[model samples]
Target chain A: MPSPSSTKPKVSALGSFIVIVWLMVLAVAAFLATVVPEIDTLLGRSHLDRTVISAAQAAIAITTVVLLILALSIMKEVYIGRKLR
Target chain B: MLQAITVVLYGAIVSAVSFFAVYFLVPVMIKRLVASGHVVQDYHKPDKPKVPRPAGPALMAGIAASEIILYILTLDSSVLAILFTTAIAFVVGLVDDRKVMPGWFKPGALLLAAIPIIVLGAHPDHLNLIFGRVFIPLLYIPLVFIVIPIAGNTINSIDVLNGVASGFLIIATIPLLVSIAIFGNQDTFLAALPLLFTTLAFYKYHKFPSRIFPGDSGTVLLGALFGALAVAGSSEIIGVIVLLPAVMNSFLFLASVKKIIEHRQVKARPVTLLGDFRLAASKDKSAPITLVRLILADGPLGEREIGIQIFKLAVFAAIMALASIGIQYYFLKDVIR
Candidate 1:
């Protein structure tokens, strides 16, 4: 398992990082989805309560981030193998 | 109304992310595949010989990864209707990427991919045709799947150049996004906006003489995303029309491949270069066409020139997108109320 390269693959690594951060964001969102329970309570008491659209959006975002990580991990694996070969 | 909007927007964003993710990862995947010995590296061919070694497998890895992610995300969010459709499209692409299937099998897969949408409440209820007094069925399930996958594969074929395939996709999406805006489909607007942006970013690196190629990953992603969006837009006829540009490009490439193959057989040569654009040449041709020469040439429009031509057609697709919207407004506008 060679470390990811800092050359041509740097951009891909950047994408991987984006996905990683996105994953964190999604985790926080899913947590918030359970913790808040109600849209009004979530928004009135917390900073994230804006619209039902927002929560649904967070769900979509989290899902996308998770997907992004899956894509990037594939990329990372491919990139490292290519670089080494 | 709000919930509907959210759903549409979610679809659009997912489409966008799906497209770019595939585009970005394909090159790396190719490198990996080459390394893993799953695919062999063709180094003997001239043109960009020094750019590491990965090639075909990268395309597969990128495509497979993106599709899996797409399916997972769809299940996670319960966007079931489009999920299975995309999965079918992905498998079709995967098969195409791995090995050539029988000609009929390809079309069969396309039809299969179109099933989920047709069955799970995704069909467009509006029908429009050129001739008067001809009653076309609103639930045109057969045509939808048949044509959509054909369109998808066509776009995939034409996507040989950098920026060309993605460029056409962005162009096609603009009108869809606009239609959503005018008709007040806010959710779709939010989701699809990112597609435009991500594709643009990809274009920056993908344009002619590209640093990287989209390969199968990019092509399959574009195909599925476009198919899903067209269906999700609920403006099927127009979506099909807007995609005509890609249709033309793909046709041209297909013709070229056919001619090249036929010429090779007729000449009894190892390779035959069609016209001046030498993808592969007949064994007898003294000056066989090469990919490098075709890319670098000023005249004798080869794949590069054809790619740009396809882009021009995409600009025209904007009109088709608008027309589709208008037609949708005529039929479905009242339903939403």
Candidate 2:
């Protein structure tokens, strides 16, 4: 068998794209981490019922989860779609 | 000034011990393992050389010895926590290396590794989320159990090509070391040196055209220790961020396969070996998606090139991790403390 080639491979656009997506995810996560607590404090100061504040926090948390799922879905679609093409 | 000198000396001793231990032990392991007929074929290579595996004992020995010395000097329970967690993960991985285990075995077994951290009270109640911190006193315990298995299995999954596991560990570790140094105590920073140096020494042999593979034991030990370090140092988010590529690889694999199954048992490989020995993404839709496969989406490449690409992704993740650290330092400095 011939010796395997040692040619340098070009970094794919997809690799760069994935890194960008990762950054986006981090940014979103950081934004939520910063904002959610403030939102909780603001609601607390408004003298809203404890149940209402808790419900809003839970909703925000659920939305964050949904967003993460959507991002993963996009990643999977892009990966499979690229291969198919 | 005298305190600074002592800290430097301690760090140097830990680094030297771990580095030299793996450096000296790997060759002996190769000879003994091969003599005992415990070798596996390098599937990605053209020659199909039989390489001895489970360099785990040597790796564990190096890490444990260094951490033991650190604990003796400082009497820190966190040091003991890292050492015990890594030792337990090493044993779990070694068992898998010697036996044909089901897919669930390693992940399930790794959860037990978290016991040392919890029992030793090594983890913090608050999570550092870069922009803010969250006090998750009750939730953090379960998170510890989940994080170890995820970290252990994530590294285990990415050990596909030669040097990838060790190489990835070397890259992914930089941010952890940096984060620990910035936000953690001197002891925690000293505790992380062995991880960097051990993997560095192991990579000399485990790199392209590997002389010996890390197998399950080595990978899981490194991964679990990494998780333990992050937890012990209170840099969990930084750990996850630095390991995003491996985490993404695991996510893709699980999503594509839609089940917890051994890669060995999977009938459809994500990448196919070509005539020239370069790897191409499998055209089969049934194949599980992987980072290697994603990298090969554009075209086939040699194993070493693929490894380099993976490292590049890791470096990108490391940069992002550093940026996250910057965010914490510049913006959340008052909030975090």
Leading candidate by TM-score: 2
> DockQ for each of the predicted structures, in order?
0.01, 0.42
lDDT of 1 by residue, B245-314 (tens): 4553343334334432212123343232343333332333232232222222222333444455556556
Best by lDDT: 2
Cα deviation of B314, candidate 1, in Å: 1.4
What TM-score against the true chain A does chain A of each candidate get? 0.37, 0.64
Residue range B80-138, candidate 2, lDDT tens digits: 99999999999999999999999999999999999999999989887787767766676
Off by over 4 Å in 2: A1-8, A42-63, B335-337
Q: Give all TM-scores, in the order shown.
A: 0.55, 0.93
As a whole number from 0 to 100, the lDDT of residue A29 in candidate 2 is: 63
Weakest 10 consecutive residues of candidate 1 chain A by summed lDDT: A1-10
